[model samples]
Target chain A: MVEITVKVVGQRTRRLKVDPGTTIAELLRRVGQNRETVVVRLNGRIVAEEERLKEGDLIEVIPVVTGG
Target chain B: MLRCSFCGRRAVYHRRYAGVFLCDRCLIKSVERRFRRAINENKLILPGERVAVAVSGGKDSVACMHLLHDYCRGKRCELVAITIDEGIKGYRDESLPIARENAEMLGVEHHVVSFREAFGATLDEMVKVAAQRSTGLNPCTYCGVLRRSLLNQAARELGADRLATGHNLDDETQAIMLNYIRADLSRLYRLGPGYSPRQGFVPRIKPLREIPEKEVALFALLKGIKVHLAVCPYASGIHMEVRDFLNSLESNHPNSKFMILRMFDEIKPHLEAAVPGFEARGCESCGEPTSSTLCKSCELLQGLGLMRRRKNLIFVEPS
Candidate 1:
């Protein structure tokens, strides 16, 4: 099992245990986020949703919607 | 690991619609290039024009401002920023500083017009009073009409040749689909690259119309452009549903947003021919251009008991 941290910027952060080599897409689905609505960063670098997350990966999800 | 299509750097974005994997540098470059292409293709701007950009301090708007700033650097076009504060507590107030910061960072002259200043009531107060009076109107109805009016007025007062907005492909597609769903031909005609010039109205141009919303967000993120990334608390309704539907549709059918935009463009000329342009007259109450007797903002304010019209004079009651 791989343990990783997920942070939805401006919302919440949580540590989760998942199977080894979890993709960002799977993490987003687990966290109840739509791929269309947010951008993902793994370990401080922007990454594709299909990019696999490794152990100790710090994934940050930044929502794209904004109010003016 | 997927390699960037343009350069073999680490891929950061996988554009499913185009089947391209792009690194941060290539993504930023392509987004900027697409922005410039939209401007050039549509003739959205010209040399030596003073442009007022509607910056909400959001990803799309701030990215629009940033790209426009870079595009206008050598073209002798002046870029200014205008932010309309709808006075939504915790929403507008939070974004106000981000907008200011972005404009200051770009050294662009920024102007903030607020609902309180223009209509004598903040949106929060208006929403409260509206609820108490059973107005049955959503907060978006009030905010949209008022904000558009204020932005235009501010742009015209700034002597801007054109007012630029950061409406990406997703926004363009949603608006097109929504208008089609409502069969609102008049509004459908208005959803082009540039709005038709009218008296007392600054021509509005959208340069980011070709880029996708995700690309705009990614561009802003990669470029280190600061933006307020909070969704509006009152962003529910049919529009949200349409946005979600479109997003889902696009997810399943990649390039659907671009297809919708392209389809609209193809039919826009026909739509324009069928539906004649609106004849706007100065509002009797405030002299702002309106199709009806009173402008929408004035009508809303009057309906909410915040403004009263008497003998060609309108008096706003301070909230």
Candidate 2:
């Protein structure tokens, strides 16, 4: 298992343990977010949803939608 | 790891609708190409004209300013920026600096008009009064009408040929759907890329209308641009609900937003014939262009007791 930290900018931060070879898409799904409303970054670099996670990987999910 | 479909570099974004992955460079290029295409295809701008961009310091507006800064150079167009301060204490105050910074960075002239100065009340104050008076209108209705009026007035005073706003594909689609739901054909007809010019009203143009909200935010991030990412406190309404519904639909069916936009475009021309002629006249209260005697802004202000009729003229009461 790999432990990862997901920080949702302007929201909350969560650390979770997941299986190896988990994709960012899977992580977001676990956290109740989807790709349509956010952009994901892994280790300070923007990444695609298909990018797999590594041990101690730090992911940032920034919600890009705003009203008004 | 996946590679960019075009350049074979490590991909950064998966454009699901297009079935392709893009690296940072390719993504930037793709965004720029589409922006130019939208402008050219719609003839949104003309050479040697001045465009006043409405920069609210958000990702979409900031990205629009930056892209227009570059695009305007080749076209020999002058770019100016206008930021409307709606007097939301924590929100608009925080964004004003970011908007100023980007305008200064691009050496574009920037102007700010506040709700307090124009309407004699801050949005917060107006909301309080509205609640106290039991006005059954949402805050967005007031903000939308007043802010749009301020943008037009500022742009016209600045001698801008066009007032540009940062409305992305998501916003456009949501508006389209909302108007459809409300059966407001007049507003639906006015949702095209360029609005027809009216006396006392500078025509508005939306250059970022084709790009999705996510891509605009991502473009700003990849280019190291700083943007204020705060959402408004008074953002809940039917529009927000529509936004969520559309987002979910787009998530399940890739290109759903694009499909809706395409369908709107296909049927938009017919809306003109159905809606009939619109005759714009100066509002009796504010002298702004409107289809009726009083502009929507003046009506909202009057409803909130922020303005009163005095000696055959409407004067804003000091709140």
Candidate 3:
């Protein structure tokens, strides 16, 4: 089984490993993320929630922020 | 891979309205350039002026502070951070530290003003009281009005020439549409990027108004700026719906958001004569500038019985 790293790029970078080929949605769920509240970047590129991960892929989950 | 239109590098963002794909460097440059252009085109700030950026510790505000700091380099203008702690226990308490952290990182002076100190109660306490009294208004209504008022007051007291907020394109367009739906012409006129010098009120400037919210988020991440990711608990209601609706529409129509903002801009000038204007007055309670008998903050506090609470309530019970 291949492993991918999920790095939450928010207040603190919380890292976790998950099985490869995981959908961004599943990755968010495994990482305890709310899909509606964040933007997901797979490796260096922003991707859709349904995008699948590959082995050794780095995911950056950033919170969606608006106005002051 | 979508290549950046400017440079032959892998694109990090696809700006739909502009129909352009940009690499990280190009995107950041574009955002910065546009930010400066927004300020320069509108004459938002003059040389030798101080700008107080309202930092919420969120990516938008933190990123804004950093950008403004960069823009202030080698110039007579200065940038400072002003964070208002609304006393939202789980929400704001978590974000306040990051605000200070960002300010420190950017080497800008940071000042935190709290509702507890300024209004004699935290938002948590105020919300609890409002809930107890069955107040129909949402927390955001009171929070937004009071926060804006306090920001203006604090900025003015800090000797700032302008108070800058981190309102991006999505927020601006969503606000414009919401005002249209509610037929709030006056607020609609106030939704643009820069405010003119009004009597007794420090002008508010929004440099990020031309940038998309997602791009701003990506820009912050690319720059490694630390920001609070959690959304406010009271961010629901009609505003959220309007935001979502606009997002969906923009996803299909691409540039629909920009079109709406442009339309609003086109119509805003004509609205000046159409909408009835009010002469500014001073609040009877606090002497802050107001359009009515009492300023919004005082009126809100009066409704919440804070005016009464602010009085000396130290009673010696039959000692």
Candidate 4:
């Protein structure tokens, strides 16, 4: 299992334990979030939800947003 | 590891739509290139022309302001930031400072226009009044009309040669889709990177038209620009649904967003001659160009009873 700190910018930060390699999509599903409405960032870099996260990874899920 | 399409560096963004992976450097270059190309191809701006950049302090508009400022430095054009405070209470109040900060940082002259000054009411008040009357229009629709009016009036008063907005490919595509669904051919005809010149109206331009929303945000991030991150409190309804739908479609189909935009561009030229010429006369109440005797802003205000609804549309011929 891998321990990673998850932080959603402008929202919340947490630490979680996950399998050796878990995709961001699975993490979002576990958190009960709609993948289409959130941007997954791993270690300060935007990544696809399909990105496989690693131990000690810092993850952020930002809501899908743009200005009018 | 995926490599940048142009550079040998490790890729940061894999644009499935284009089948290209870009690193931070290459990505920035690509975005900037698109920005310049949109302007050059569409002639959105001419040398020495002053552009009033509408900034909402969001990543999209702020990125636009910064990009245009940099682009204008060499092109000998001038940029001024125009931000409209829709008076959404918690919303506009929070975003204003960020707009000011970015304008100050860019050394561009900033103009903050308010609904209170223009229409004697904040959007929050407008919403309350509208709800009491049970108006058919949504808050976003009212706010959009008012904001567009104020932006244009401010830009025109400032003697700007053009008014530039930060609309991206996603925004454009969503709008196109909406207009298409509504069968609003005239509105669809007007959707493009640059709006042609019309008397009594400052031409509007969108230099970021070719870029995607996510990339605009990433460009802002990579440029170390600070922008307001909060979404508007009233951003619910059809627009949001359309945005979500298009986003999901893009995710599944990759280049679907670009395909929509490209398709619109192809259709726009054919629409030019077919779309009937529109002529605007001085609005009876606001004196702005309107096919109706009263401008949309004035008509809307009249609905709020903020202004007396003059029976002027009867005399005004359709444009």
The candidate that wins on lDDT is 2
For residues B127-214, write the lDDT of model 2, one tens digit per residue.
Answer: 9998999998888989999899888888877889999899999999999999999999888989978896568889898888989999
Docking class of 1: medium
Candidate 4 CA-lDDT value: 0.82
Docking quality tier of model 3: incorrect
Which runs in model 3 stand beyond 4 Å of their true positions?
A: A1-38, A44-61, A65-68, B308-319
lDDT by residue (B198-255, candidate 4, tens digit) is 6778999999888888888777776678987788989888788888888778766778
lDDT digits (tens) for residues B1-319 of candidate 3: 4577889787666666687777889888888998899989988878889999999998888888998998888468988789999999798999999999989977898888888877789988888888888888789988998889888878887788899999999889889988889988888888788986458899999999988888888788777788887789878889988887887687668788789889988988899997787788888898778888898888888888885122221122474
Looking at model 2, residue B116 earns an lDDT score of 82
- All candidates: DockQ: 0.56, 0.78, 0.20, 0.37
In model 2, how large is the Cα lDDT of residue B243?
94
- Evaluate model 2: give its TM-score: 0.95
All candidates in order of TM-score, best leading = 2, 1, 4, 3
Question: How well does candidate 3 score on lDDT at residue B62?
Answer: 87
State in Å the error of residue B48, model 2: 0.7
**What are the fnat scores of the candidates, in the order listed?**
0.54, 0.77, 0.17, 0.12
- lDDT digits (tens) for residues A2-64 of candidate 4: 998877667568899999778887898787665545666788776656677788999888764
Docking class of 4: acceptable
Question: Which prediction has more favorable DockQ, 3 or 4?
Answer: 4
Any residue pairs clashing in model 4, and if so which? B17-B255
